[model samples]
Target: MPVLHSAIHKIDKKPDGTPAVLFLGGAEQVESQARDDLMHQFNESYNGTAGKGWGFFHAESGAFPLSGWLGKYLAGVGDFLKFSTIAVEHLVRLMEESNLTTGGHALFCHYQQGLTEYLIIALVQETEAVTMTEELSLLTIKRLDLDHIRLAARINLSEWKGNPQSKQYISYIKGKQGRRINEYFRDFIGSQEGIDGPSETRTLLKAFSDFVESEDLPEESAREKTHALVSYSMAQAKLGEPITLDELSGLIDEDRPKSFYDFIKAKDYGLSETLPPDKKTLNKFRRFTGRAEGLSISFEAHLLGDKIKFNPADGTLTMRGLPTQLTEQLKRATA
Candidate 1:
């Protein structure tokens, strides 16, 4: 539960005048929570929700890291997680926008990184032991029978990293490059390999079987743009909402996948790629609602900045007495 943050703290007043964040830390720190709530209140005295929270802050660099509620990724133990880079980005952005991010990160744990699972599985094929279904199942009262295919499917379809790899499993997670095991998985396991037979179940089965037959895997790729894939996968798993096509496309930065193969998989029940007819843009009405509260505060701040006198009746802001030239300059600046 310990959080890491850069050493610098304190927001200094800037001569140019945009508000700079001071006193940075993980946003979940109770004291930081209180402070952000106060800022949200000023930003929205009329709006509700009590200004719950914001993304956590990094002190020295001032970067706000997304909160980690997605369960810890399990590594070395199994294959899964590494496939969900897009989902992870979306998760962080959603948390930041909603002001719900709490700021924690996974060094590693419980779920597998999907993108890399296959190659590692292939590499380890010769070994005496495998991370078989019996070892990783999180079965409940409702389900019976061991499920390796679906388990692998979910991890591959989900996020990119989990943790605690032993010497045997370290390479995939070596530098946190999600693309590694993932590319091969896509190239080898989850790729659109030809499937035989009718049932979607049959297709999945064929895919799994075909994967076990691929070539010896290569080295893992180096990562770019440090990602928050684990965070997103956890959010999507928890929310359980079907994503819109646009949202899905946005999530991966990739052009939408050419075929319906991902959607065709049987294990992905309740998942959706259909987009709303009127694609969601911004919600400006929500913006106007919050502006109602601090409109006066903003006006007052504006007044203080100028040596101005105001008449109660006129809606216009004016300085009662000033030299014409200076008044004109102030009016221009205000405008």
Candidate 2:
């Protein structure tokens, strides 16, 4: 990772709605091993965090002017330190307006990973810890709480510059459902939700299922394909990368590399070329298949507890609310 520029500022505020104070960093950070390590750790945590939403920046205007300031910095109109100061000032104003008094260290990092450039903005807090000295004396210290990163956003500079019309170039922690806690932070960055992670993942799975059904593959072949999909998706998630449809299709079947991709395109699933996989949905996605003497059964793993139940002691499977088509066929056969 090559860090172009980095800075950390401080926001002092209390939870009792006290006035906020902004302390801006005087200069951009110099390249160092510690800086590199911090960026790496932050990336790992951000990637592993769930409930992140992807979107593009809102229009650069008075209300959401961070992008304009960033544009000036990127265009060589001002130094990074100046730009970060202005940005943090805007954050302070938003925090005050939102009645959000919680404050911490705000980190801004501009770095390059591989051929792509990214800008990461995060608010990190510190936790106290006890450590023993070389003489065995106990000492207390404060360390960054990287494990519990709640307020952060990463902008894909490469994508935003290359594809101005793209809507999913910005990814940020959106907090859990029914909570608008991160709304102000999002407004500070001027981003809106463009893609629903869980919904998109579900759609991708549905498209995969349709492709399998259309191909009429054998049980073993289907199982292999399923494993290939899950493994590739999980690996991408671990690396903090999105699943590329074409690349995944090739991995699924080397002989017919474009088969799946073409199927998805023809069906119009409305999936982007690359999709951020939702780990929770992927974990719940699995196929339970069983075949015995003239008996075959298959269903999704998520349906096990709701529609299907298995008894380990009795070695039996019981299914409720059978499909209407199957029930109608059974009734006709009995009649």
Candidate 3:
């Protein structure tokens, strides 16, 4: 939920500058249902049992026990799966075309499975420009099972401090760096070690499986810190005051000696590398001003500048000067 919110909240005109979403569903069912209805209408012509009642000729005659419903349901489900696959392929193609993106895009799915079952899938990609040349993309895959409950897995596809986006079609930083889309899905559904993927991938898959089995586990990752930053910003914007870096970390129970930003960069998002984020990584994203006595540091998003200023002395941030677009969002949120 947090990921989805961060991906699409208050953002308009996705990086593609278009609809960014390709929806496919129920296109053929209209025609098929029409044909079935017409046939049933004609069958109704049988007036009495002396001849053959409509029930005698077709499965539609028995509404409860249904005749052709099984076949129809299966066909419909097949079409849904087919379209969802196509949508993913299209999304990947779009990502390959644009080297950089500035918004978010996603594919949502919910299709019938059986008489009482349904399948749901959502693939999301949220992008934001961190600087002139660098961007951050959060990629997520979610699904709902027979219980109609949703579970998800996410990968931050952003490049490391010195790294750049790959020119190829499929790259997932730590895991599946150059693997294909299908390969990613296969590895996700199958075995983790089969693809030799990143630990984050394994963790997410385990989390998803555990959720389905009602064996959920606690998850702690550098990515959680990214979401924490977003959460902290939203809170600060609402309170109209800056909270100290230590206060922010304490609120989230992130007791690590190194900053969250630095830890994330060091881990490379749990890709192949493992390191804590440092001042260098922090400075790359923002201007980190450290306090000697308090041993606290404050940061300002260089891109946002004065709109979101930080005071290291009191360890509070004042967003009164935030950009017009973001201030408007804050107003809408608080309203």
Evaluated with TM-score, which candidate comes out highest?
A: 2
Q: How accurate locally, in lDDT, is each candidate?
A: 0.25, 0.88, 0.31
- TM-scores of the candidates are 0.16, 0.95, 0.16
Q: Clash number for every model?
A: 24, 0, 9
Between 1 and 2, whose lDDT is larger? 2
> Model 1 residue 315 lDDT?
45
What lDDT tens digits, residue by residue, belong to model 1 across residues 1-335? 11111111222323353433333323222335543433233222211111111111122211222112222213233122332232233333433443331222211122222233311111101112233367786543321111111111112212123332211111111112244433332322222222111122223223322221221111111010001122332233233211243343334324443222343343353322321111011110010011233342111122333555445588445544565986899899999
**Which parts of model 1 have CA positions greater than 4 angstroms off?**
1-152, 155-175, 192-241, 244-289, 292-335
The predicted structure with the larger lDDT, 1 or 3, is 3
TM-score between candidate 3 and the true structure: 0.16
lDDT by residue (tens digit), candidate 2, 199-276: 989999999988887787778888999999999998888766778999999998899999999999999999999988
The C-alpha RMSD of each candidate to the native structure, in angstroms, is: 26.5, 1.7, 25.5
Span of ten consecutive residues with least summed lDDT in model 2: 174-183
Ranking by TM-score: 2, 3, 1
lDDT of 3 at 12: 26
